[model samples]
Target: MITIYDWFGYELPIKERYQLIKKVGFDGVLLWWSEGFGRNYYRDAPQIVREAGLFIENIHTPVQNQNHLWLDNLDGESLTDCYLQCVADCAEFEIPTMVVHLPSEDNPYNTLGLNRIKRIAEKAEQLGINVAFENLRNLANLAYVLKQVDSLRIGFCYDCGHHYHYYPDDDLLSMYGSRLMALHLHDIGGSYSQHQLPFDGPINWAAAMKKIAEKNYSGATAIEAMNWDYKHLSAEKFLQEAFERAKRLEALRLYNP
Candidate 1:
C-alpha cells in the first residue's frame, strides 16, 4: 500500500488533512504518536484517520530525549518508560508497527541503552507489535543495538534521506534489510537532510528501490516528505505529487531491472 506521513506540512484540521490524503489516492498514513502535536487531537488521530477512510500504517514515536535511552541517569530511565508506553499505545491503537529514532549524532552505545531497547522489545513482543529502529548519523550504535537485541519483533526502518546524507557509503538495506519493517522515503540535495519528494533531489531512486525489492519487503511504500520547501503549493497539489511519486516508487520496486 502507498502511505505518507500525516503531518506533511499542512495546517488544516487533522480530519481534513486525512481526508485530503485519502482523496489524493494514498492508501494509509504514518502518524506521530506524541502529544507534541496536541494531546487530544493526536490521541484521537487513529479514529480520525480511519473515519476518513485511511489505514494507519504505523505510528512514529516522539524523538525528544531519545538519546537518554543511552545515559545511566534518571532521564534515561524516564525515556525507557516513555518508549514502553509508546509500545503499549501501539497495541491500544492497533497500529502494527512503531518507527523509532535511536540516539542522535554519534552517541555511544552502552549496556544501559541495550537494556532499555530490550525492555521495549519485550513489551512489543508481548503486545504483538513491531518496533522499527531508524538509521541516523552513527552506524555503529545502530549496529550494536540491532546485534544485541535479537527480538524478532525488533526491526529496521530505513530512511532514504538519512542514509544518503549521513552514511552514503554504507549499504544499510543490505545490512538490516532482512529485518526491515518500514520505510521513510524522501530525498536530499545540497547539504542538509531535506525531506523532499522523490526525484526532487540527488538520491538514486532506482538503486534504492532495487535494494528494497531485493529484500522482498511487502509493506507499505511510505513517504515521509515534509512541506517546508513546497509551501507555495496547495495541500491537494502537494499530495497529488506525492501520490504520483509513491506510485513511481512502487513501480520501481516491482521492476526486475
Candidate 2:
C-alpha cells in the first residue's frame, strides 16, 4: 500500500531519530545515502532503521555542487561517481528506490547529462533498483533526458515545493505523470522553496492534491519537509503537527482519479 514517510537525517542520532519519526505516525523513513566522516557510518543504516521498527522508503543521493556531472571540465572523477556509489549502496541495502537531482540551471541539458543518466539507468537495471530523477529549475532538460534514456529503470520524482517555487506555470505532473516513481511533498510560498509544512504556505493544496490523486500515484507519499521553520515548537509538538498534516494529505489519495 502507498504510505507516508518522513525524511531521516543524522540530526538526533540514528536510532533516536528513527524512533521519533515512528512515534510521529510516519509509516517509513527516507534516508540520505551518505558516507559521512569518511567512516561509512551509513553501513549500519538498514539495521538501525529496522531495529527502530521503521521501513526505509528510499535513499537520496549526494547533490553538493553536483553540476560537474554535466560539465565538460571534469578531468577524471566527478560528482557522478559519488552518485553511482550511492546507487550501489542502495542496492546493497536492498532499498528499492533512489532520488537524484541534476545540475543547477547554470548547466544546460547536453549529451554529457544524457550519457550519465544512461549509465546510471543501466546500473540501476543491473541491480534491480529504480532511479527517480527530481525536477529542479531544469524541467525541460529533465524531460529531455528522460525521453532520451527511455528506460523503465528511470523515472520522475516530483517535488511540490520546487514546482511551486520554480515553475508555477508549468504542469510538471502532467509532463511526467506516467513516469512518477517518487515524491518530495512539501509547501512553499512566493519565492523561496521553503519546504514548509503543507497548508502553511501559499500553494494550492487542493489542486495539487487532486492532481496527485488523478495520476493514480501509488508510490511513496513522502513528505520532504523540515521543522526548522518552527524552531519555537517543541520537538514532540512539531512532530504531532507534522503527523496530523500528513494524515490530511494522505486522505487526498482517496479522491477519485
- Among the numbered candidates, top TM-score falls to 1
Error of model 2, residue 49, in angstroms:
1.0
Candidate RMSDs in Å, in order, are 1.3, 2.5
lDDT of 2 by residue, 49-102 (tens): 888787888887866656777776662146767767777888888888998887
Give lDDT tens digits, candidate 1, residues 24-116: 999999998887756457888999999999999999988877778899889989888988998899999899999888987668888878888
**Residue pairs with backbone atoms closer than 3 Å in model 1 (clashes):** none
Model 1 TM: 0.97
Q: What lDDT does model 2 reach?
A: 0.76
Q: Where does candidate 2 stray beyond 4 Å?
A: 1-11, 35-40, 73-76, 190-193
Q: Each candidate: what lDDT? A: 0.90, 0.76
Candidate maximizing lDDT: 1
